[model samples]
Each structure stands twice: as structure tokens, then as C-alpha cells.
Target chain A: MRQHLKKAGIILFWLLVWQLVSLLVHNSVMLVGPVETIKCLCRLVVTADFWLSIWYTFWRIGLGFLCASLLGILLAFAGAKKLILGEFLSPFFAALKSVPVASFVVLLLIWFGSKNLSFFTSLIVVLPILYGSTREGLANNDKKLLEMAQVFRIPFGAKLHYILLPGLSPFWKSAFSLALGMCWKAGVAAEVIGQPLQSIGNRLYQAKIYLETGDLLAWTVVIILLSFGVEKAFARLLRLLPGEEKKEPDSMKEKGDVA
Target chain B: MTIQVDHVSKFFDGQPVLDNFCMELSDGNSYLLTGPSGSGKTTLLRILLGLTRPDSGRVRLLGDYKYSAVHAGVVFQEDRLCEPFSAVENVAMVSKKLSPRIAREALEKLLPADALDKPVRELSGGMRRRVAIVRALCVPSDVLLFDEPFTGLDRENRKKAIDLILAEKGSVPLLITGHSDEDLGFCHPIDIRTGVPLQMG
Candidate 1:
């Protein structure tokens, strides 16, 4: 309850600032007021194109994020178990992490057309984070627990499920939370630069091109909601996996066996 | 039917823990290894459990390679129970799946039935110690190693935990290290002193 109240207070405080800024700006094109932006949002909601663009941008980026996360986890497991493989991937992952996003996007545009540029860009951008964080999570886990598991003759799968997953969940959460936002932003950026028709990023680019400030503000709101909504959904699923395990602790043994 | 430790010795930074240590146990029996704090009790246990290597000599089981402890179960001094798992799951972790009734029955002797549902992280320190005891005992193993199993438990809880071990794991060739006579009640402890074999002085 305290958290909810804190969040409500922050929202109200920000809305008051938006109201003040809107009144000061006066010119509608220069900055669309929050009230007008909401009105513009409601108007756009009635259109089929807006929904299509939202879904399009959402799924494409969602796919890229999923691909990177799954492969990252798999690679982390491999690298953890095999020192040689882990050493081999060190420089590659390091370079991937240090390389700027703009450079990847520009290079990807040349390799792939604007339509699929965002998809590839999202994959390249999120992979290093997922890899690095999951690797660190695996490496940072308590060695004592692993020794105990070994002495107990725990099966390989059980070790991964019980020992490995719980250890990695925190890192995975942070990695996914951060990577989800980046994928959406970079995916949209790719679309904007590439100007793929019938996409949210394309719509955003068009808004900027014509100086349709109301449309621009409305689209920005859509992007924020999409990104925020998706992240919340992922976090909810994460909370639920452990939540469902809570009601019956013993059942977790079976789940742990499968984990 | 027996484990053989032929002239096994280990040193860390030139300090010997197991200096030409030799011992053997056949079939089902238990031995309490009494030694000073750093007198290789844990190092010996680790070698027997295949988690460490000796500087000289080797451990063999029934004339087999030393990796045999891949089948051994161990209860460490720090109660290496998974903090997020309940008492029952921690024991059931190594057992066959589909909710073994033995797992529930194992914790019944040492922990409250309600604790079977609470994660070990929520349990008190003494409670976690009991859970670790249950885990090592419930799972099948030819051998078990306990490194000072009853260090921090209160007298009453320690006695109860000891009783649970005797009842659950009868004659399991257990190797334990502790100064307390409480553990000696369960088995005859073989004293290993550092500078030389324990003298009667």
C-alpha cells in the first residue's frame, strides 16, 4: 500500500509539472499539452492503423528479445561448464558490449533492408547484455552450494533447475528488464531511420517529418505504454513462476527437478 | 565392500593436514573423526568424498578409482541446505521424483510438520541444521561425512538432532568430526592429532 501511494504521488507530481510546462509553452505545435495529448491518443485508438503499428512493433522486438535471452542462457550454461568455450567467447562478448548501438544499427541497415533492420538490431543489441549478465550470475553463484550438490550426487538437470535457476533468476530479471526496454527503443529507432511503412517507428518518423506535434506526442505515449506494458507483463510472469511455487513448497521439488 | 585410503597425505602451502593418513571401513558402520580445528578433518573428509586431491597417495573404493564419491552424500558444517527450499524438498532433492513419502517422514522426526512447507531461509539456524541432517540421511549413500554437525545447536536441539540421525541412518558408514561427546554417543570416534597420532598423555 505504501508503494502504491508513493507511485500515485510521483504520478501526480509529474502531471503537475506537465501542466505547468504546457501552460508556459502556449504554442500548441511547440509542445502538446497533456490533456490534448490524451485527446489525441483517444482519437488514434479508434484507428486500425495505430493498433496494427503497435502490434507490429511489439512482436518484432519481442521476438528479438526472446531469441537473445534464450541463446544467452544456453551460452552461459555452456561457458560455465566448459572453461575453453567460456574463454573463447570472452573477447566477442566484450566487443559486443562495448560497441555502440548506433554503429550496429547503421551496419545492420546495409546488411538488411529497413523493414527487418530493427529485428536484427534488437537481437545484436540485447545479446551481449543477456550473455554478460547471465555469465556473471553463473560465475558469481555460491561455490559451496555446488560442492554440496556434487557430494549429494545430484543429477545434472536437478543442479541446473534448483541450484542454477535460483542463482540466475535475479541476473536474468535485471538483464531482461533492461534488455526489453533497449530492444523496443532501438527497434523503433531502426524503424524510424529505415522508415518502414506501416510501423510505429515509421509513424513516429512521419510525425517528426511533418511537425505534427500532437501526433508525435501521442505516438511517444504509445511507445512508452507499449514498452512499459511489455516489461510489466514479463515481470509479472517472473513473479508468478516463483509465486506459484510458493503455495505448495513441496511441489517445488518436482518443479526443481524439471527446472 | 570396503573403502581403502592407502598412504594418503595432503598439504596446503606446505602445511600438512593429512600426513600419510590411512584408514578403512567395510560395510555399514559409523566413525566419528575427532581432531583439532585445522588438523585435516575436513581435508580428509573432502578426499574421501572425492571433492579434493591428495598431494601423495590416493583413495580407492573396493579397488575402484577415486571418483567413486560421485555417489557419496555429505552434510557440511554450515548446513549447505538450499535456502529457498523447504526442509522436505531439500531432502527430496536427491531422491526419485513424484513426492516421496520418505522425504516427509524423514523431516517429521527432526522438524515440525509446518516447517516442511516453509523454505529453509525462513527457518532458524538450528532448524536449518536439522534440515541438512535430514537431507544427508534421507538420500541413499554408501557413505556420509559430517564436519562438526552440531556446532551451534542448543543442548536440547542437538540431542534431538542426534536422536533423529541414529533413528534414520542406522549404520551408514558415517564419518563425522566433532569435539562434543554428544556425537560420540552415535559412534566410536577415531581421534587424529596433528603433530603425531594422539598420545595418551
Candidate 2:
């Protein structure tokens, strides 16, 4: 409770600073305070279009993220099995990591158009991260444990449940946290460029065109909330997976051994 | 099943770990491998499990085996229990034939009931070693290879563990590597350095 109150107090302090800056500027067009942004958000939430825009962006990006995660895991397994495939795809993933999101957005717009821009953009943005993390996780699995499994002639299903999943958990947790945020930022950017209909990005574009600072800030706030909500929800879902429990710390183990 | 290690030699960095080693492990017998540290005890176990390749010579399985490969239940030098999993999970994970109930019962012989559900990492070294021993015994196999299984175990716990292993081994060839032959008088002692069976007085 104290930690939560401390967080809220910190947020209030920032909000006060923002309000003072806006008042000194004295131009609502250039800057809007937290109050005005909240008021705009309240007005916008009553409209069906607002909800529609959210649904449109949410499902497309969510589906894209889902597809990327699945494909990335499959490809990582394949790559781990085939050394040549891993060697072959190394440069491609490297290029994907380094290429500008804007370049991909523009290219995707030309090829696929605005209808599914967010979907494709988010998929491309998230795939390499999941793939790399999964591959690293596979590489980091304990060789001794694997040898034990092999000697025991344990079935593949049991090996996956007992060994592979637990080894992959930490890597996937960090990768999901990172990829979730990147997919949203890239997905929304793609929508803004493509000017997709019934999208938060489209509204953001419109807000920019008319210089509606309040709407722009309100939409930004919405994006932040949506990103945070999806991350938390995804984390909760990951915790539900079997074999995802926290391991006892090494210090505790050492102390036990000493005793 | 009989394992034939005929003139097997392994070299690492131009040093002979197992120089012209030979041993024939037959069914319904137990062998205790005794050697000083860095005397290729672990390398021999790894060779038997097919985890490492002998630079010269071959290992063969002579038996009326249905499969071409030898299925072994091995306890590595290190406690290779999945650190995040409980002792019961570790034991039961090796084979579907061994249910959680069976695992719990077997573990109760060597470990306390309360430590059965806690993650093996939270357990002491002695407890974790017991979990590894139980895991090896729970699996169905043609042979059992345990390397330094008595590490981190007390005299009482070691006696209990040996009793459990003997009771559960089920006529398979049991090869254990350790430093001393005092606790393992029942097992035929093999000097790993010389690759010869020592006479039991």
C-alpha cells in the first residue's frame, strides 16, 4: 500500500509540473495539461467510434503478435535442429533487427496497403526478438540434464515438460516484455503512415492534421494504457503456464549446503 | 544385458584419461569403480552412456535386446536434477511408467516427506543427491550408471541409499563410481586407473 501511494504521489508531482508548464505557455494549441487531456478522453470515450477504433487496432495487433510468437518458436526449434538453417538465417534476422521501422512501414504500405498494415508491421517487428530469445534459451539448456534425460530414455513429451519449457521460461518472459512494447509502437506507427480507417493511429493522424493537442495527448495516453494493460495481461497468462514457477535462489541453496 | 568395453581408450589434450581400458559388465551384477580424482571415472561413465566418444576402440552391448541401443539410467557426477522441479517431479519425469505415487514412495525411503514437494534446489546437497539416486532407479533400463552417487551423503543416508538402490535395481548391471570401497563391500571393486578388478579379501 505504501509503495502504491508513493507511485501515485510521484505521478501527481509530474502532472503538477505538466499543468504549470501548460499554464505558462498559455496556448492550448501548442500544449494541453493533464486536465484537458483527461477531459478530451472522457468526451471521446462516449462515442462508438472510439470503441470501434480501439477494437480495430487491438485485434489486428493482437493477432499479429500471436502469429509471430508461434512462428518464431517453431522456427527457433527448426533452426536449433539444423545448423545450416541457423547459419543461413543469421544474417536475415540481423538485417531485420537493424532496418528502420519507417522503411518497413513504407514498404509494407506499398505491397499490402492500409487495411492490414498494423498486423503485418507488428508481426515483422516481433518475430526476430522471439526467435532470438528462443534460440538462446535452447542453447542455454543444461547439457548434463539433457544427457540424463537421454540415458533414462525419457519420452520427448516428458523432456519438453520437465526440461525445455523450464529452461525457456526466463528468456521468453524478457522477450515477451520487450516484443510487446515494440509491436505496439511499430503497429501504431504503421497505421499512422497507412492512414488505416477506424484505427487509433488514424485518429492520431487526424488530431495532428487539425492541431488538436488535447486529442493527440489523449490518444497517446490511451496507447500507453493499452500497452501497459496488454503487457500485464500477457505476463499473467505466462504465469499460468506449467513449469513457470520461480526457482529457489542460489544463495539459499548454498546456505542449505553449508548447514 | 552385458556391456563390453573392449580396449577402450580416451585421450583429452594429448593426455590419456582411459588408456586401453577394458571391462565387461554383465547382468545381475554390480561393479564399484574406484579411482583417484582426475582418473577418468566420469569419462568412462560418459563413454558407457554414449555421451562421449572413445578415441580408440568400441563399446558393445551383448544381449537379446530388442532395440539396437542400450537404455541406461544414469546419475551423473553432478546432481543433474532439474533444479526448479520437486523431488517427486524429478523422479517421475524419467518415465511415464513411474507415477507420482510410485515416485513419492521411492523418495520417502531416502528423503523426508516434507522435502518431496519442495524444489530440489531448496534442498541440501545430500537431499538433492538422494533425489538423483531415486530418479536413476525409477527409470526402466537395461543398465544403471551412477558416478560418485555418495557425494554429500552421510554414513546413515549412504547406507539407506545403497539399500534402496539394491532393492530397486531389478537384476540390471549396476556400475557405480566412487572414491572408497569401504561402504560398497558388496560390489565387485574395479580399479579404474588399471582397468582391473581388485581381489576382495
Candidate 3:
């Protein structure tokens, strides 16, 4: 309860600061307070364009993220198994990490047009992160467990499911969270640059062009809420796996079990 | 089944770990591979389990077409139970013949009843050691390899572990590396450093 109160207080203090700054500026077109942003969000939520825009951006970005994460994991597994593959892919992954997102957005816009720009942009932004993390996770896997499996002759599939999957869960969870946030940010940025039809990015561009600061703030809040919601849902799903749960021994509760 | 290691040798960083070591053991006999700390007992076992190639020797497992790893169940020098899994799950995951109930019964003999359901990471070292032993013993294999299997067990639990191993490993050849006379019980002891057999009477 104390933690909850502290968090609420921090949010309230930030809101008060924003309200005071907006009042001092005395220009609603240039800056909007939290109340005005929330009102704009309430008004926007009832409109059909709002839902369609969200759906468009969500599916395109979500699809790209899913494809990149799966492909990254597969490539990382292959690379970890074969040293030559890892060596060949290292330079490519490094280049992806270092190159600017705007350059990719401009180049992709020229090639693929606006319809699929965000999807490809999201994939380009997320792949290197997931790939690097998956390879690192595989490299850090417990050698002793692997040797035990080999000595016992545990089948390949069982080793993957029982040992490797569980061992990689922590890395996978962290990578997914990081990649999900980056996917949204890059996807929207691409949509804004490309001006795709019925996208949150298109909405943001329209609001900026009209100088509606309240709408821009409201849409930004929506993006943050969507990102937070997806991250929390995905993390909760991961925690549901049997290997991830931290259950106390039932016998320990009954007394005199360990002693 | 027969395990024949014909003149195996291993070297690391210009140091001799196993120099022309040779041994042979067959079905229905237990052998204790006794050696000093750096005498390559683990190297020999690794060679037998097909984990490492003998620098200049051949290891042949006769009587089955399965690979050496498939034929041998091992309690590794370290307790290598999957940290997130319960002890019963660890045993049952590796064992082809033992169901969870049977694995639990086998484990209860060596591990406390409460520790059986807890993940191996939460269990103490001694408990984890018994989980490793139970996993190796319950698994279906033609032979067993135990490398210092009783390292963390107390006197009582060590005797219980040995008894459990004996009860479960029926008619299969056993190769173990240990210095304790009690752990060797009825198995023929061989000093791996000298490559000579020693009688433990």
C-alpha cells in the first residue's frame, strides 16, 4: 500500500507540474495540460477512425515483431550450434545494430511504399536485439547440464524442451520486452514518415499539421498505454509457464517435512 | 555388455592427464575406479561415455548397437540436475523405465520427503547429490557410471544411496570413481593412477 501511494504521488506531482507550465505558457495550441489531453483521449475513443487506426498500426507492427523474434531465435540457435554460421552472421548483426533507423525508413519507403513500411521497419529494428540476446543465452547455458544430458543420452527434442527452453526463458523474456517497445516506437516513426492510411502515425501527423497539441498528447498517451498493456500481457503469459513459476513446497507448509 | 578401453591417453597444456591408460570391464561386475585427484579418472570415464575422444586409443562397447552414451547412465562429478525442475521430474525425465511414483520411492530412500518436490536449485547440496544418483540409477541403461557420487552425502545417506543404487541397478556393470572403502562395498577397486587392480576386502 505504501508503494502504491508513492507511485500515485509521483504521477500526481508530474501532472501538477505539467498543468502549471501549460497555464504559464497560456497558449493551448502550443502545449496542452493533462486534463485537456485526457479529454481529447476520451473524445477520440468514441470515434470509428480511432479504433481503425489503432487496429491498423497494431497488426502491422505486431506481425513484424512476431516474425523478427521467431527468425532471430532460429538464426541464433543455428549460429550457436555452428561456429562458422556465428562468424558469418556477426558482421551483419553488428551493422544492423549500428545503422540509423531513419536511413532504413527512407530506403524502405522508396522500395515498398507506405502500406507495409511500418511492418518492415519494426522487423528491421527488432531483429538485431533478439538475435544477440538469444545467442548470448545459448552461449551462457549450463555446460554441466548439457554434459549430463549427453551422458544420459537424452533425446534431442527432450534436451531442447526440458533444458534449453527453460534455460533461455530469462533471456527470451527480457528480449521480448525490449523488442516490443522498440517495435512500437520504430513502427510509428515509420508510419509518420510514410503517412500510411488509417494509422496512429497518420493521425499524429494530421494533428501536428493542424497544430492540435492536445490530440498529439492524447495519441502519445494511447501509444504508451498500448505498449504497456502488451508488455504486461506478454510477461504475464511467460510467467504462466511451469518452469517460470516459483511455487513453495506444499509439504513445507504442513510442518516437520524437512526437519 | 562389455566396455573395452584399449590404451587411452589424454594431455592438457603439455601436462599428462591420462598416459596410455587401459582398462576392461564386463557385464554383471562392479568396478571402482580409484585414483588421485589429477589421475584422469574423469577423463577415462568421459572416454568411456563417448564424451571425449581418447588421444590414441579405441573404446568399444559390445553387445548392443546403441551409442556408448545411450548405453551408459552417469552421476556426473557435479550434481547436474536441471535447476528449475523438481527432483522427481529430474529422475523421471532421464529414466525410461521409472515412473514418477517409482522415482519418488527411490528418491525418498536417499532424499527427505519434502525435498523431493522442491526444485533442485532450492535443495541443499546433499539433497541434490541424491537426486543425481536417483536419476542415474532409475534410468534404463546397460551400464552405470558414478563419479564421486557420494561427495556431499553424510555417512548414513551415503550408505542409503549405495543401497538404493545396488537395488535398482540389476545385473548391469557399474563403474564408479571414489576413494571411500564403504562406498566401494562389493565392487572391485582399481587404482587408475597405477593401472593396477586393488582388492577391497
Candidate 4:
């Protein structure tokens, strides 16, 4: 809510200036009013095609992000435990992080069909962020606490659930939040270039084809809102995970056997 | 079980922190580890904890190697509690089955009772020191190793912390390292000088 309130204040301040600029310019073609954009959004929302377009893009982009996060977390754990594996993956992660999104989109389009284009693009963008943050968090974990756990013969599952998870949560959550936003932006950009059917990117391509700047702007708003909603939802989900609660004595028990 | 150190030598950057040091604990009992600064008191504790290996010789327990049994519970000079977590959570991180009331009781002896709910970062230096000692005691270990466990506490807090350490179960042995004469009053510490002693804690 704090973030939303801050966002609302910023957008309102910018919108007031945008409205004044549109009125002074006296041309919707040059600079559209916020109200006009809202009107365009409302009109698009009434259509089933627009809703389908939104869902199609959302699924593809969301899947890519999910895949990236899972693999990134697994790889991070592996890389943290083994120096050789970490060394092997270093240049590979660096390459993915430094490469341009457009370049990857073009290369991936040639490799995969346009239908799954956004999925691949999202993975490429999200992977390095999750991997880097998780590795750093694991490396900087409370070494003394780990030693204490070892001396006490703490159950392996308990060590992961209690010590490792709490330590890694902040890094994972922040990386996931940023990566979610990046994946959505890059995924949409890829879709716009590829023009997948029943997708927001395809709608954007259509708008540009017909010179409908308002349609382009409206679809852009839908993409942003959907991405923001997902990020907020995921953050809530992260909080709900069992490992997140700091006060473990209240809830933690011998949950089966330690691996 | 006895912890025996036999002719162990340790060097950091070739400075010879400890040379041919040795000590033997008779059995499960209390011991005060005392030495001058740079006498390798902390390094000896680290060797006992298996955190640092001796450059030569070995530390063994009951004729077995160190870490072979549930060896030692260590309290370092620094209060290394997790900053974002409550003092109780920091303790619980090491001892999963550690009861809340038990942890509270352990902390209550050395700290203000109200500090149980506060994060370690919000705690005062003395309070964190107490928490660290409580954490080490909370873990069920065969031998307790404390490194400068009474650094910042005033006389009142120090007595309380020492009392808490005494309150722990007797089956586990306690070895403490400190520079204060008052700290040595609780147990007759074998005086260790620079270079190597023929005995160990």
C-alpha cells in the first residue's frame, strides 16, 4: 500500500502536467490527455479480443518468469555449494546479463516459433538477476549461525527452513520483483516484434499498422497494470510461504525427516 | 569424555601464534582458559571448535578425533546473532527443537526480560553478549567453548551471565577463555603462557 500510494502521487503529479501540455498544444495527436488514454482503455476493456490479448501475453510472460526463477534458484544453490560449478556458470551468467534483449529476441525468434517467443525472452531477462542475488545472499549468510547449527546437530531440513530460507528470502524477493517487471517489459517488446496472435504485442503491432496511437497507448497501460498486479500478488505469496515467518517456535515442528 | 590436545602448533602468516601447545580435559567438568593477549587463547578455542586446524599435531576426544562426537558448543568473542531476527529467533536458528520458554528463561537471566521480543540489532551490546552466551548454552553439546564471553558487560551483568552458564546441564563440560581475574575466580584455570604449553583445555 505504501508503494501504491507513492506511485499514485507520482502519476497524479505527472498527469496534471500532461493535461496542461495537451491543452496548450491543442492537439491530441501530438500529446494525448490522461483522460483520453483512460477512455481508450475503457473502450478496449469492453471488447473480448482485448481481454484475450491481455491473458495470452500474461500467461506466456508469467510462465517464462516462473521457469527462470525456479531454475535460477536451483542453479544458485548448486553454484554456492561447488566452486567448480560456480566457476563454470560465471561467464555464462555474465553473457546473459550483458547481452541486449532485442538481440536475444531476434535470435530466439529464428530458433522458436512466434507463439512461444515471449516465453524465451522473459527467461533470458530474468535468469541472471535471480541467480546473482541468490548466490550473494547464500555466500553472505551468517557463518557463525551455521557453525552453531552444525555443532548442535540441527536437522538438515530445519537448517534450510530456519537459517538458509530466512537469509535468502530478502534477496530472492527483491530479485524476483525486479525480474518480474523486466521479463514483462522485455516479453511484451518481443511480442510486439513477433506479433503473436491473441497477444497484447500483436494488438500493439496492429495499432502501429493502422497508425492508432491511442490503441497503442491503451494496450501499453493494460500490460503495465497486469504486470504490476502480478508483482504485488507474488510479493503477497512470498510472505505466505512457510519459511518466511521469523518466529519459528510458534509454527515450526519436526516436519517429517531431514534430508 | 575427555578432550585431549597433543603437541599442536598453529601459525598465522608465519608469526607462530601457538607452538607445540597441549592440554587435556580430565572429563565433563568446568574449566577456565586464561592467557595474556596474543597468547593464542582464541586460536586454541578455534582449534577445539574445528574452525581452525593446527599446523601440526592433533586434538582428540576420548581417544577419538575432534568433531567425531557431538564435540563442542562455541561462543565467540563477537555476538554474531542474526541482525534482522529476534534474539530468540537467532537462538532457534541453531537449536530447532529449542522451546520458546526455555530460550526466554535462558535470555532472562542475563538480559532484561522485555528484550526477548526485540531484534538483535535493536539490542544493546551487553544484551547481545548475553544472547550469544544463551545461544551457545541452548545447543545440547558435550563441551561448551566460550571465547571472551564477558567483554562489555558491567559487574552486575557479568555475574548474571556467569550464573546462566553455571545453570546449564552438568553432563556437558564448559571451557571458557577470558583475560579477567574475576572471570577466573569461578574455576581454577591452568595458566598458559606464550609459545607452547604441554597441556590443553
Instruction: Provide a comma-separated list of chain B TM-scores, one per candidate.
Output: 0.86, 0.95, 0.91, 0.89
lDDT of 1 by residue, A40-82 (tens): 8999999999999988877888888889888877887798789
Docking class of 3: medium
- lDDT: the better of candidates 2 and 4: 2
DockQ-superior candidate, 2 or 3: 2
Best by TM-score: 2
TM-score computed on alpha carbons, candidate 1: 0.90
RMSD of each: 5.3, 4.1, 3.5, 6.3
What residue runs in model 4 are displaced by over 4 Å at the alpha carbon? A1-13, A20-31, A235-259, B63-70, B183-186, B194-201
Give the alpha carbon lDDT tens digit for every residue of B1-201 in model 3.
877777677888878898777677778899988878978988888888787887787776767656635377788898888888899889888855668898888888887798888778999898888888888887778889999999978898888888888888889899889877785668987888767432223
Q: Tens digit of lDDT per residue, candidate 4, span B131-198?
A: 88888888767788888888888998888788768777466667888877684575647555533244
Q: What is the C-alpha lDDT of each candidate?
A: 0.79, 0.90, 0.86, 0.80
Q: How big an interface RMSD has model 4?
A: 3.1
Best by DockQ: 2
Q: Estimate each model's TM-score.
A: 0.90, 0.95, 0.93, 0.87
lDDT of 3 at B17: 90
Cα displacement (Å) at residue B109, model 3: 2.8
lDDT of 2 by residue, B1-201 (tens): 888888889999999999999888889999999889999999998888788899998888877667756888878889988887899999998888888999999999999899999888999999999998998888888899999999999999999999998999999999999887766887988888777632233
Which should have the higher TM-score, number 3 or number 4? 3
Docking level for model 1: acceptable
DockQ scores for all predicted structures: 0.47, 0.76, 0.64, 0.33
